[model samples]
Target: MERRPRRRLLLHGLVGLALLLADLPALASSLAAWRITRQGALELRTSPNVSLQAFFEAGTRLRGPRVWVDLPGAPSRTRSIRGSGDVREVRIGRPTPDTTRLVLEFRPGTELNPADLRLVGTAADRWRMDLRGLSRPVLLGLGEGDIEGSATVAYSPPAPFPTSGAPLSADGLPVVPRDRFKVVIDPGHGGPDPGAVGIGGLRETDVVLDVSLQVARLLQARGVQVVMTRTSEVDVDLPPRVALANRVGADVFVSVHANALSMARPDVNGIETFYFSSSSSRRLAGSLQGQMLAVSPGSPDRGVKAGRFFVIRRTVMPSALVEMGFVTGGLDSPRLANPAHRRRLALALAAGVLQYLGGR
Candidate 1:
């Protein structure tokens, strides 16, 4: 009887070990590497074999300004890496058996605002945190309790378009006639993705869609061929938006979006535009910025910037992404909610597109 009991226990132990071994691959995710990009942002890369699940919590801790990234299911490990710019060092440790923690220590006197931190990536395997546009640092005395803030994850890489289309050339450039000038206007976010919520519960999706529709209408009135990525409140991924423009051989691609900051920053308001590659794209961005500023009185001109947003980057044509104004701004929210104001903004956008095309 004793021998039989021992044999049963041995069998149970083997089964348990086998189950643990089966789950080892899923739990083997770890911090593979990290580097600071030319933009002065911190980029973190995880093991690609498994999906990454990380929770970032940042604030002024009792010790100082710090950010804690918790990785559940990660193994216990201790390591430290030197940091650049405002970050003094990054320390990796196992806070609990099931949780791996990454502590980011900032230089003394660094004013860490959660709003300035933006985490963007398509997959968890690679993520980038932008901290270059931080406001001037201020000395907040240590032990001021926790000034809590959360980082916003934005943007994703473009996926392949769902439906089959005409095959592209060897260079991945679509073959189409350039006889007529074509434009594609994409309104950012819709349906399930309400985008940034602003003052009085104003949604970014609704605002941008209204502005884009008016823009398309005005452009059509001028006898220009216009294509819209979305005409109603429905979800459209970044891939199809870019594919449509490329397949049709559009001359220009413009995406409309509204800016947003924390609710605490009601005073922060501005108009900015983004473009990727080519001097022609830069010119388009400049034209849009100027016209929008001319009509949007009292709104600060945030200028044109280079951004690698999926829609703007993947499109073959000269493209620009315009952030009309801050939806969270005290001044901008009311104006954006007004149909007449949106109409004026639309007119300015249409005029900007015409201006760019005219110069071509």
Candidate 2:
């Protein structure tokens, strides 16, 4: 009888342990299901000073089950957001278009750490990640199969905004001017890949998309056609992107993206330009960098770099990728998330296109 009571307690204890073990996976599954969404599509902007904002694009919905969304001028931070069913009001802290920032919520006990960030590049724009609690040794890789376990993935960027800088051909023959050039803007990373996330919940793709549209509009207004690789929120592969660019006979290809880092106190903020592996690409990158700095005064010049990006590597025309800014640095995030700063960036890029075309 004495042993019976003790045995009963032991049995109950074993059952409790089993139950606890069962619940762990459930907890993890629940954690995996936690998601984030924006009511209308969020606008991406470049920052000036310490300001960041997401001007809402009404009727454009950006809904997903991802952990977080990035903003301009911020580093990659993971989060889970949801709505209260009916037309949920999304708030970003500024009154003006350039200063407003959207708000999000997360599960209780979730940690927000700034130091756990590492920068990884997608096909074009990149992410500044804080992957402290998201599994271990988080990674960012390319290819469709074998995605790293628990690692975030990025989507291809939207089509580049077309250029109106068609002046003359190499033979001194003037290139015919179209009403609007059909430009395919590529904003890299989507779906599972939240490229970079910084303060005010900034995202890499979100930031590039905003700038891409602005660049598109600027060129369209100047009588150029514009097409986007992935207009809404969708993933695009490299081969398809290359085919699209070639299909449209893109006069110039510009991939829009942000930059990131992975180090202690690695506050990296600067502007870098890239072209395919060619001598002329260097000149184009240099020219674009100069033009970008013209509008963004006091910005760091990382100089033109040489890299064999898949999109740039495969494209047959003049192609370049622009790293507008970084989201992780103390001084960079605010600079990236500001609307004025983005506008200036767009203007500088436009001027660069003009110069490139005029020179030819």
Candidate 3:
């Protein structure tokens, strides 16, 4: 009887221990590292398990511009790092017991536009906040009326193309009016970022650059004002590219890139285009996808997709990102490598833009 009682007591103690373990909270995530890039952007690396929530707030004369990033379920901690240019300092603190916060402080008299500040990265743990290439004045005089005045800018629709005497391009598409329409062409990757490398040692940066240049020439010849994100070999971060388009008030923004897959799967190849929110962007993507498929009948039609890519999401104007074809694919590699085929592809893309503009 004494042995049975002891055995029951041991079983109850084991059950109590499991209940205690189950009631305990999970381990909190943390910031792994952080640094400022040469381009004057703040880059933060978080623990792989962290999910970030961030926002920017405009500052006044008393305080500086600030950006707050919250990491939930994290412990209280305080840290600071010096910043350059517009940013004066970066601080990490605990705003709440369960939330760790990161604050970016801008220099005094600096007026940061919320649109100009962007946080971009695809990964859950890696992010970059870029404030460079701000077209607005950094310093503004403080006035009593400034607080009451409306900051909204009136929207003006683009001037319609002249119905009569509109010259037609050799491809039978209507030419855009001279100096009336602007298009920003962004070649996806360049310089240090080689993008996708595929069959026969073909580089995505090289192919996209060539096609984008050709597209620019085609558009320029048709009297459309063309702006290229990169004209040569150089690394251009995502924020500046969007900033340029927004600053210039571009009518259309298109980022050109080649898709890639594993070399072992050469069968995966297609033309696809992506757009963020907005009906205009969706229509533009659809037009581009249709035109690309019309040119390369043999290539698979991947169709238009909705994506949250930074360039397309941040640009104020209608934007699309086009993936020409897979670099690793058996069929796409040879065509992308050929100069004449690239020209054909460029013509198709240009036609798509013209088609959209004309319809609009």
Candidate 4:
């Protein structure tokens, strides 16, 4: 057959070649906007929990409780189209019980024509929401409408949590009798995981790595053995980050990351340390929080909180996560961005490690 026009051919490829990895019957929801399937079975799924999955050909735009997908695929050249009504943001509460809706606000405009929207993946709640935006067919044109309006949708996901409780602190962590403990510092996010971006191209990974290395060097100078999750800018999944510390038989574990809140600047300030419920985690958070502030004077003290994060939650030893500063919002960004401030953060973290060992 003669080759179809370039644009048309590309559009047709949206369904994609059925691949071996794709479970044929499973339908994946697009994270962007509401979808109405025409032919073939569609499965809507969000990660860690499969929401909707079934085989179907014809489907209508069902206004559920919380989701917004881009208007049926649209032409590249089409800036705006006359939508019958307004479309809004989508919110997700839980995966097991998936609910989505559209929020629209209407204002008078001369022949309101809204731009065709496409769905982007969901934020966190696992890659499920993000994966929803993956596969979609193209809709090149739109019907008549001079619609002008806006809508907002909210998804409140049940707290994402894993199945098991964390290992208790120092109970049977293989901590040997030693002068100083072998501490492994894990700097969260690197490579592909930009973590969070800032005004000055400051990346979380680069900053944390620098701080981790500093902490390591400081500890080493004090006759304490030190190990780092990574020495270079590279991708390291969460699991492996902890494994490094475990592998090195580290006496304690510390995971470091800067916080970010773009939409709403958090009024909360200063350092907040987190530990798993396990006994080990508690001790670790206490130690880190105390010293992190000692080095960085005036650092906001959020105090130590407990939560199950992969690194600290699973570690067999005392573990804690240090939120050095809020990268976005409040006044934490400017200071965290300073090299002297970063060095102080490192030194304080190192000192915490020393203090924790001293406690025992």
Clashes of 2: 55
- Which of the two, 1 or 3, has more TM-score? 3
User: lDDT tens digits, residues 227-340, model 2?
Assistant: 566544334455656777887687777777887764233366788888877665566677778978777666688889887777778877777888887766556668778776
Q: Candidate 3 local accuracy as lDDT?
A: 0.67
Predictions in order: lDDT: 0.63, 0.47, 0.67, 0.48
Q: Considering TM-score, where higher is better, how would the candidates rank from best to worst?
A: 3, 1, 2, 4
TM-score of each: 0.52, 0.50, 0.55, 0.50
Clashes of 3: 0
lDDT of 4 by residue, 1-360 (tens): 001111100001113111011111223322232322222111122222122211111112443122222211121222322232221221222222222212221212212111111121121111111212212322222222211112211111122211112211222122333555677777776544557765466677667877776766656556666665544443445655565566667788888888776636646457788988877678878888887777666667878998767787767787888888776645677777777778777767876777778767
- List where candidate 2 sits over 4 angstroms from the true fold: 1-176, 180-182, 263-266
Q: Per-residue alpha-carbon lDDT of model 1 for 304-333, expressed as tens digits?
A: 999888888888889999999998999888
After the best TM-score superposition of candidate 2, give how far the Cα of residue 182 lies from its true spot, in angstroms: 4.7
- Worst 10 contiguous positions by lDDT, candidate 4: 1-10
**Lowest-lDDT window of 10 residues in candidate 3?**
1-10
For model 4, the local distance difference test gives 0.48
**Candidate 3 C-alpha error for residue 71, in Å:** 42
